[model samples]
Target: MSNTAQELKAEILRLTRDYSALVHRANRAGTENSVPFEPGKTTVPYAGRVFDQDEVEAAVGATLDFWLTLGPEGEAFERELAGFLGVKHSLLVNSGSSANLIAIAALTTHKLPANRRVQPGDEVITVAAGFPTTVAPILQVGAVPVFIDNDPATGNARVEQLEAAFSPGKTKAVMMAHALGNPFDLSSVLEFCRRHDLWLIEDNCDALGCTYSMPIARANALGIIENSPGIPANGTHVTRYTGTWGDISTQSFYPPHHLTMGEGGAVNLVSRPPLKTYAASFRDWGRDCWCASGKDDTCGKRFNWKLGELPRGYDHKYIYSHLGYNLKPLDPQAAIGRQQLKKLPAFIEARKRNWEVLREGLAEFADKFDFTLPTHATGWTPEGFTWDATGCRTECSWFGFMLRVKPGAGFTHTDLARHLESKKIGNRMFFGGNLLRQPVFVQLRKDRPSSFRVLGAMPGADEIMERALFLGTYPGLTTTMLEYELQVIRDFVRQA
Candidate 1:
C-alpha cells in the first residue's frame, strides 16, 4: 500500500468517529452523552448494544482492510478475551449456540480417554430452567442430558440434586450455565464433578466477568493453583473468573450480551492446552490440522504421518477428524470485540451498579417480590449481602435484575408484565423457564423415552416459569430511565 492509501484510511477513520459521535449518542454508555428521556413514554429496552466511536472506528478500520475472514483481528480478540478470563484459549465462533456446539463436540473427539469421552449413550447433566442451546448441544452431540431442578432464589442449578441425576457409569459430564450472571454453586458443583471424575463445562455466555471464590484449602483440593491474572490473592481464598473454574466454557458477544460484536461468541479452553487443539478443529470445519486461518503448520511437518488409513502425507489440511461445522465469525466483528474488551471493566461495574440501583429502589416491596441472590448469599441489606456458613462467595456481573412475584401477591407475573409493557418499561422472563416444558423437549420425550432423564418434579422450575421476571441491568440504561421503571412498578403495586 502507498502512503496515499494510508493517509486516506486515517482520514476516513477520523470522519467515522465524528459521524458516530453525532449519530450514536443514544447508544453510548449511560451518562456518556445525554439522550432525552420521558416518563412512561420513551421505550426502555431490556438489553442492547452500548458502544461509542471506539467500536465504530475499529469496525470501520477492519472493514477498510478487507480481510473479511477470521484473520489478524480475530486472533487478537481471541487472545485478549482468553487473557481476560485467564483461560488457555478462546476460539471465536458465529454465535453462542455454535460455541456451545463446538465445546460439546470437542469432548466427543476420539483423542479423549474412552471413559471420559462423551459417547452416544453417555449422559451430561444440566439444569432444567435455562436457555435451550445449553442443553440442545448435548443432544446434538448424541449425549443424553439429565435434567436437575434450579433454585428459584438464585436462578441456578440445585446442586444438591446432582447425585440423584448422575448415573455411575453413564454420566460423563456436568454442563450448566451461570444463570443471569450469578455464578452457580461452583463449590458444590466442582466437588461433585471431582468425586465422580466428570468433566465440567460452564455455559458462561451470560457471565463473562463474574468471579467465584472458595477457601484456599478447598480450591487447592480442586487443583486450582493461582488467581486469575489481575485478581489479587487475599491469602484466604482462590478467586478466579467463572469461565476459568471449569474445563471448558462458552461466551456470547451478541448485541444483547455483556458485549457486542454484532454476532459472535467463543469457546474457552480453561485448563487444558489439548482442548484448544480439539476445540479449534471443531470450529474450523473438523479438519485435523491446527493451522490458523491464512497460516501454515505450527506443527513443523504438516505432511508428517498418516492416520485413519489415509495415504501417507495426505494434505494434512484435508484430513477430517470430527463431524464439525464452520462457526468462525468475521475479522471486522472481532475488531469491534477488541474495542469492547477494552471497556469491559467499566461495563462490568456499570452492570453491578445498575442492579444495585434497581434493588435498592424496589426494596420497599420486598413483601410482594422475591429477588435473586448470588450463590451462597443468604440475605441482602443496604449495607451488603449475608453469606452462608460455607466459605464460597460470588461477585456477579449481573445480566439482569430478576424478581419473583410472590404467590398471592394480589397479581400474577403476567399482570405485572402487562402493566410494565403498558408503561413501556421492558422486562423478560427467565429464559425458556423450565426448558423441559417447552414443545421440543416434550416431543423428544415422546419420541425417545431414553434420550433424557428428569430427577424430580422440578417445583422450583415451575415457580420460575410462573412467577419470575427480570428487568435490564445492561450498561446502556440511564438513571432517569431506571427511575421511571421504578416509579411505574411502585405505582402498579400500590394500585394492586
Candidate 2:
C-alpha cells in the first residue's frame, strides 16, 4: 500500500474517534436533566440500547474500512462472543430470528447422522408463550412444533409437561427460551433431553448472562463442568451460563436486547465442531466451503475432491451443502458488537441492580400483584431478600421486572399498564403470551389443524396473557428513573 493510502486511513480513523467523542458529549448533554420524570409526560422506555463513544468509533472505523460484508470484524466479534459465552464457536447472523432459523436448519443438515438429524415432521417441544421466532423456525423447516404450557411466574415452559409432549421417536428436540432472562428449569429440561435423547436449543437472546446450576452428572455430560471464573464449582453441582447448557444457543444484539450492534445476532454452537460447520454453512450461503470470508481452499482438497454428483475439482466454494439462507450480518455491525461486548459485564450488572430495586420496591404490594421471580432448581429459598441456593440455583441478569395482577386485585393488568403509561413509565406484555391465541397461530390451526400439536390446555399461558406485564430493567434506566417508576406503581396500587 502507498504511504498516501496509509496516511488517509490514519486520518479517517482519527476523525472517527473525534466524531465519536463529540457524539458522546452531545448524548450526555442532551440527557442531562433534559426530561425530568413527569407523570403522563416523559416516556420511560421498557428497553433500549445503552452505548457509548467506543461503539460509535468502532462502527465508524469499520465503515472507513468499507468492507461492508461479513469479514474480519465479524470473525473477531464471533471469537470474542464465543470466549464470553465459553462456547466452542459463534456464528454471526442478521437477526436473532435468523439465528433461530439457522440454528434449527443446522440440525437438519445431512452432515448429522439420519438417526440424530431433525427430519421434516420431527417434533420439537417449545413453550406456548414466547417470541414467535422461537417456534417459527420449527415450522419453517417443516418440523412439527409441540407446544407446552408456560409457568406463569417464571414465563418458562412447564417442565412437568415435557414427558406429555414427547413422542417416542417423533420427538427430536426441545427448543425453548430463557424467557425474559429468567432461565427455565435447566435441570429438568436437561434430564428430560438426556433420557429421551433429544436435542436442546436454548433461545438465549433474552438471557445472555443468566447462569444455571446443574447436577454434576448432567453438567459433566454437557461439558459445562469446567469452572467459571469467580463462580465456585464444588459439591454435587456445577454452574454454567444458560446458553451453554443447551446443544445450540442463540443471542440477539438488537437495540432492545442485552447488548446492541444496531441489528445483529449469533448462533452459538456449544456441543461440537460438526454442528458449528453445519451452522456456518447455513449462514454463509450454504457453501460447502469452510473458508472464512475472502479466503479460499481452507480444506486442501477444496478443488481436489467431489461432493455428491459434482465433478472432481469443481470449486468447493461453489458447492451447496444444505439448503440455506444468506443470514450473515455486515462487518460494521459486528464491529459495534465487539465494542458493546466490552461493556456487557457492566450492562449485565446494571440490569440486575435495576431489577432488584424494582423487586424490593414492589415487595410491599406483593398481595396486590404476583411478581415473577427467576426460577431456580430444587431446594432454593429466599433468605431475607436474596434467594438462598440450597441445591441448584439460577443467577439471572434479569431482562425485565415481571408483574402479574392477582385475580382479586382491584386493578387489572390493562388498568395497571395504562396507569404506568399515563405516568410516562413504559411497560410491555410478555411476548406473544399464549401464542396459540395469537392470530397467526389461530389461522395456522384453522387452515391446517394438523400443522402443530398442543399437549394440554395452556392454563398458565392464559393467566400470563391476562395478567402479566413487565417493566424495564435495561442498563439505560437510572436510579431516578427506577425510583419514579416505583412511585408510579405504588401510587396506582395505593389509590386502588
Candidate 3:
C-alpha cells in the first residue's frame, strides 16, 4: 500500500464525513439531532435510515478500498454480528429473504441425516401471517409449508397449534419469524421441535435485539444452556436473543431493521459448526470449498475432494455441493453495517422506549384498538406489562407499534391508516397479512392444493388482515414526531 493511496483514502473519508454530517443531521438518532417538526407537513416515516457521519465514512472508506465484493469488511461485520447475538457464525447475504432462502436450502442438503434432511414434499411449519418470504423459501425448496394461525395479540404463531400442524414422518422443520420484533412462544416452539426432532429456523430479521427467556429449569429441559452475551443470568432464567435460540436464524440489515447495511442480511448458525458450512455453501453458489472470497485452499485439501460423481482431486472451488445461489452483499454495505452495529444497543433501547411511549399514550383507547402485547404478556398497565402464568417472558425491541382497530370502533383499520396518512404519519399493515389471501398464495392454492397445508380457518390471521396496522418505533422518531402522531390519533379517535 502506497503512502499516496493511504492519504487519498483518509482525505476521502474525512470529506465523506463532512458531507454526511451536513446533509444527514435529520437522519441522526432523534436524541442526538432534531429534525424540524411541522405537524401534518413533515412526513413521519414508519422507518428510515438513522445514521450520521460514522456510517458514511465507513462506507466511503470501504468503497475506496475497491474490494466491492464481500471481503474483509464483510468478514469483520459477520464476526461482530455473531458476537453480538452469541451465535456460532453469521453468513452475510444480499437480503433477509435471501438469508431465509439459504437457510432453507441448507436444510435440503444431503449432508444431514436422511430423516432430518428436508426433501420435496416434506413439511415445514410456519405461521400464516407476517412476511411472505419467510414461507416462500419452503416451497422454493420443494418442501410443503404447513401454515398455522398467528395470535393476533402477539402477532406471532399460535404455538398450541404446533402439534396440529405437524405431520409425523413428513414434518421436517419449523420456519417462522419473530413477528414485528416480538419474540414468539419460543418455549413452546422449542419443545415441540425437540419432541418431533424437527429443525427450527428462526427468521429473526425483525427481532434482532429482542430477548426471550424461560425459567432456568424449563430452559434446561429444552437443552438451552447459555444466556446471550451481556445478559446476566439471574439464577432463575436463561435469557438469549431471539436469533440464538433456534438451529439457524436470520437477520436483515436493511435500513428499516435494527441496523442498516444499505441492503444486507445474515444467516446465523446457532450452536453448530456444521450448519455454517451448509449455509455458507448455499450462500456462496453451493461451492464445496470453505474458502472466503478472493482466497483459496483454506481447507488445504481443496484439490482432494471427490463427490457427486465429480473427478477425483477436482478443484473443490468448482465442485457444486448443493443447488445454491450467490447472495452476497457488497463490502461497502457491510462496512456500514459494522458502524451500525456499534450503535445497535442504543438503537434497540430507543425502539423499546418509543414503543412503550406509544403503548402508554394510546392505553386510553384500548377499547378502540387492541394493542400488541409481548408473547407471554397477559395485560398492560401504565406501570408495566403483566406476565402470563408460563413463567416465560419476552423483551421486544419492537419493529413497530402494532394495534388492531376494534370491531366496533366505528372505523376500520383502513380508515385509521388513511387518517394517519392524511396527517403525514407513516404506518404499515402487518406484512402480507393472512398471506394465504395474497394473490400469490391464492393462486398457489388454486393451482396445487397439495402444495401447502393450512391448519384451520385462520380467523386470527384474517382478523389481523382486516383490523391491524402499525406505527414506526424506529430510532429516528423524535419527541415532536411521536407527539404529532399521538395527537393525530387522539383527534381521530375522539372524532370517531
Candidate 4:
C-alpha cells in the first residue's frame, strides 16, 4: 500500500479506460465502407490475431509496471479464468502446447495413486486431426498414443470406435481436442473413461465455451452422483454450458486461440484434493510455497520444516517436490489476457454469427460439395463451427475451414488448395493431419509399435487434412469481408 504503488495502480486504471474508449470509437467509425477486399493480394487467413485498443493498452501499461515476470496480471487472469470456467483451479503456462504438455505430464506423476499414473508404453487414445502438441506430450513422456480415426462428418472421433482403440492390457488415458470449436460426444467418452478407469484430459484449446451432458441424465455424468472420500466424483454436469468438461481440462491463450495472453495456456482442475492440486506445484519451480507470484512466507515458519530427510530445518522456499519446468507466463501477457477476457462474450457471439452467415451462404452447395457441419451434443454450446471436407464440398466458418478429399473425388488436396490459393483465399491442413506421418513420429512409433495403434488406418485423415483449409472468422472480420470470402469460395467451386 505504498503511495507510489497506489499511484501506479491508479495510472494503470486510467490507461485501461482510455484504451477501451479508443477501441469503441474505432469500431463505430470503421463501418462497412472502411474495409475493402483486395483480390489476389489480401490474405484471407484460416485464423489470425484479433485485438482491440484495450488489449494493446493493457499490454503497454504492464510494460510500464516493469514487473516483467508473473505478477498481478498473471494472478488476476488465472483467478478470472478459473471463475469463468467454473473450475476450482487454473494455472497459467507459457503456451497452449505447453499447457497440454504439463497437463498430460501431470498425469504421469507417481504421486497420484498408481492406478492414475500413465505407465510407459501405455496407450493414450486421441485423434490425428488435432494440433501436434495434443499428442506430443504422450511421445515426450514415453507413452504410446493410439490414434482414433476421426468421423469425417463431425471432424470428431467416432464414439463407437472408442472400444476399438482400447485394449485392456495397454490403454490408460484418453486425450482429444473438441475438433475446432465443435464438441466431441462427451457423454460416451466420459463413460468409457469410467469403465476403463482412464484419465480423461480434454484439450479445450479449440472448444473453449463448449458444454456437455450425459445421455442417461440419471446422476452425475461420470456416475456416482456425488463426491466420495478417497475417490471423488461430485462433478455436476447438469446442462450449464460448453467448454467445461474434463478430469483436468486445458485452455490456450495464444493469439489465435479463444483468448490471448500473447503466448500462454492454463491447466484447470475441478474439486480435486489438496494433494492432487499440489501436484501442479512442481510446475512453478516445484516449490512448496503457495504464495502468489511476488508475496512470500504465508506459511509462518518459512525455514522450519525438514523434508526428504535433508536437515533439521530446511528452507521451505528451496524445497522441491516434483521434476517440472518453468512454464509460467509473464504478467504483461496475463494483463492482456484479463482485458481480452472482458470481451469474450462479444467474441464468441461474433464467431457464432459469422459461422451462421457462412453456413447460409454455402447452403446451396451442400449437396454438390461434401461438407460436414458440426452438430453440438445435447446441452452443449460451442464457440465456433467445424465442417469436414470429406466430400471436398463443404462450407465451414470462414475464419477458417477444413477440407478432407474423398476417395475417387476426382481432385487431389493440393489441386484444391492451389485453386483456393490462386484466388487469394487462405488454406491450411488440419494440424499435423496423421501426425504419425510426420518424421518425428516415425522413430517413436517404430520403437513402440504394439503399444501404439492408429484408428481405422486413418487413410482418409490425410485426404481430409491435406485438402482442408480455413479462413479467418476472428473478431476483426466483418460481414462484408466474410461475404466476399464466400464469393471467392463459390467461384473456385464453380470453376472446378
Measured against the true structure, the TM-scores of the candidates, in listed sequence, are 0.99, 0.94, 0.99, 0.84
Instruction: Give the Å shift of residue 91 in candidate 2.
Output: 0.4
Clashes of 4: 20
Q: Give lDDT tens digits, candidate 4, residues 1-496.
A: 6999879887776877776665444332113533455666766555555666677678877887789898888878888887877767788888888878877777876667776777788789998766889888887777888887877666777777899889886788899887777667776787798888887888888766544433324334455242211222334324423334557777887766767777888887755645334546756776666666677777888778777876956877778766767888888898889988888766776666666666567666653445545544211123444323221111122224454454455566677778767866666666777677887777766876665578767854665565555545566666666777788767766666
TM-score of candidate 1 against the unseen true structure:
0.99
Clashes of each: 0, 0, 0, 20
User: Per-residue error at 147 for model 2, in Å?
Assistant: 0.8
Off by over 4 Å in 2: 1-18, 22-40, 215-218, 221-224, 229-236, 377-390
The TM-score of predicted model 4 comes to: 0.84
Better of 2 and 3 by lDDT: 3
lDDT of 2 by residue, 274-314 (tens): 89999989988888888988888788888797888999999
Model 3 over residues 1-496: C-alpha lDDT tens digits?
8999888888888888889888888898976356667788989999999998999998888888889999999999999999999999999999999999999999999999999999999999999999999999999999999999999999999999999888899999999999999999999999999999999999999998999999999999999989999999899999999999889999988889999997889999998799899999998888888899999999999888878898899999899888889999999999999999999999999999999889889989978999999999999998888998999999998999999999999999999999999889999999999999999998998899999999979999999999999999999999888888998999999999
Cα TM-score of candidate 2: 0.94
In TM-score terms, candidate 3 sits at 0.99
lDDT of each: 0.93, 0.85, 0.93, 0.68
Task: Kindly list the per-residue Cα lDDT of model 1 for residues 156-230, writing each as its tens digit.
Answer: 999999998889899999999999999999999999999999999999999989999999999999899799989
* Model 2 clashing residue pairs (backbone): none
> In candidate 3, which residue pairs get closer than 3 Å at backbone N, Cα or C atoms, i.e. clash?
none
For model 2, where is the 10-residue window of minimal lDDT?
A: 26-35
